[model samples]
Target: MAPILKISGLSKVYDSGFTALKSVDLEIDKGEIFALLGPNGAGKTTLISIICGLVSPSGGTVVADGHDVIRDYRAARAMIGLVPQELTTDSFETVWATVSFSRGLFGKPKNPAHIEKVLKALSLYDKRDSKVMTLSGGMKRRVLIAKALAHEPEILFLDEPTAGVDVELRRDMWNVVRELRDGGVTIILTTHYIEEAEEMADRVGIINKGELMLVEDKAELMRKLGRKQLRLTLHEPLGALPEALADHGLELGKDGTEIVYTYDSQGERTGITTLLSDLSQNGIRFKDLDTSQSTLEEIFVNLVRNQQ
Candidate 1:
């Protein structure tokens, strides 16, 4: 099946001679949740803006649901819903009016039932008659989402959708996103929270310094980049790690009652058995052992650092 969205050789250069995006190529499958991860100034927002027709790309092409974003702007844009980072809305307008206005701007006929459904989906049905200015920060954020959904686009772009919201609102938004995906809406989200992406995304894409770094299945990425740590709680304090264990890059705790061994899970050998045997021969005994696998956050940091 053809991708729901396709970006090829995409590049964005500004008048200041700064390149925000460089040769980014991506394909988002239908009904999949794809997370774009990167540090500040990594071109995440720039990429989204270009795709949503909010910003012009200096080079490359983007096709959304078989419609060219540049040539078929109306059809391409009509199929996309964007929730930007900044909260810009009609403060004086009631929620219902604002959302209804957004839908009409898209040349969509009024569907009061659809509007009510969207408001209820985002938990803003009660606030429909309230002015946007009177709503809380989280509520206002929901209003933005409501406005975006009012048009009922097939693809959704959420750029830092949960950035400044409280935990409760964040969780609520995730639930909504999951519901959208379950309903076969393609979602492309850029987030700073790795845990959110880890929990919600089917695939992950990492971009850095205006370049596309890596894109892979979330589980495959984790298995490929994640490492395991062997933490040993010593039965007795040690003055220092013996010379024999120095080559293993073992980390000694300040109190000398703990030792940590970091090893690649994909290697031919994890070296745990050898390390333990060597420790026993060297008169180092441990009372307890614990292991941990690297999380998506760790892998993401390592990738960005490697690029730098």
Candidate 2:
């Protein structure tokens, strides 16, 4: 299937000669949730702004659905909904009015049914009559999402949508996002919360220093990059690792109560049997052993660190 959004050789340069994006090429499937992860100044927001038509790219092409972002700006922009990081809403307007106004901005006709559904999906239906300024920060965040969905966009860009919300509210927003994706809205979100991406995205893209580092299916990315650690609790304390175990690159754990071995689970051989045999040959006995795999957050940090 053709992508709902396609970006090719996308480059962005500012007036001060700073390049915010560099030759980025990406494709978003029709209805998948894609999480774009990056550190501060990594060009995440810049890329989103360009796609949403808030900022112009110095070079490259961005196509939303079947419309070119530059040549067919209105058509491309119409297919996308953006919830920016900053809270810029008509504070004095009621929730319903604000969201309704946003829909009209895209030249969409007044559809009270659609607006009500969006508000209710975000748990904002009850507050639809309340002034935006009177709502709490969390509620206001919901209003932003409601506003984004007002036009019933095919693609949504959420730039740090849950930045300052409480944990409970964040989780609530996650559900709303899932519902949107489930409803066939292709989602591309940039988030500081790695777990949020981990929990929600089908694919993950890591961006660093304005470069597109890696993009892969969530589970595949974890399996290919994630390392596993085997920790063996010792039956007796050993002040140091045995000379024969040096080849295993073993690390003595706290007070020599355990031995830690890091290995790639995806490799053909993890050498667990050999390591165990060597340990036994050296008078090492393990009482218990457990394993753990690297998390998405860990993989993200390592990738960013390597780029620097």
Candidate 3:
């Protein structure tokens, strides 16, 4: 199937001569949740802005669904719904009023039922009559999502949707996002929460310094770049590692009570068998041992750091 969105050689340069985005090329499939991860000023927002038609690109092309964002601005924009990082709703407007107002902005006919459904989906139905300023921070965030979905766009862009939300509310939003994707809305999310991407995204893209560093299936990326570590608790605290273990590149724990070995999971030979044998020969005894794989956050950090 053709991607729902396609970005080719997208570049953005500001009047201040700042290049916010490089030649970024990406394709997002329909009904999939794609997470774009990056540090601040990494062009994530700039990229999203260009695609949503809020910011024009200095160079490149963006096509949403079947419409060219540049040539068919209105149609392209109608296919997309953007939930910005900051709240911009009118404080005096009721929840229903603001959300319905958003739909009207796209020249969409009044659909009370659609607005109500969006409110309920975001758990804001009860607050529909409440003023925006009266709701708590979390509810305000929900209001933003409701407003974005009010127009029923085929593609949704959530830029740090859960930035200041608490853990429980954030997880709730994750579930809501999944339901949206299940209902056939292609989602493009940019988040500082790496775990959010790890928990929800089917594919992950890493951006750094205005360049898209890498994009891959989340599982495949983890398998390809993830490392595993073996930690053994010694039966007795060894004052020092045996000289015979020098080749293993082993690290002694702070108190010398633990032994650590880090190895690439993709390696043909992890050297575990040899390390164990060598340890036994050198009179090393372990009471217990455990292994752990690198987390998405760890891999993310390493990738960004290496690029720097």
Which candidate achieves the best lDDT against the true structure?
3
**Model 3 clash number:** 0
The window of 10 residues in a row where model 2 has the poorest summed lDDT is: 264-273
Q: Count the backbone clashes (under 3 Å) in each candidate.
A: 0, 0, 0
TM-score for each prediction?
0.93, 0.96, 0.95
Better of 1 and 3 by TM-score: 3
User: Which candidate number has the best TM-score?
Assistant: 2
Off by over 4 Å in 2: none
lDDT of 1 by residue, 93-176 (tens): 999999999999999999999999999999999999999999998899899888988899999999999989988779989999
Please report, in order, the local distance difference test score of every candidate based on alpha carbons. 0.93, 0.93, 0.94
For candidate 1, the per-residue lDDT at 209 reads 98
Sort by lDDT, top down from the best: 3, 1, 2
lDDT of 3 by residue, 170-202 (tens): 999999999999999999999999999999999
User: Which ranges in model 3 have alpha carbons more than 4 Å from their true place?
Assistant: 268-270
The superposed Cα distance between candidate 1 and the true structure at residue 254, in angstroms, equals: 4.1
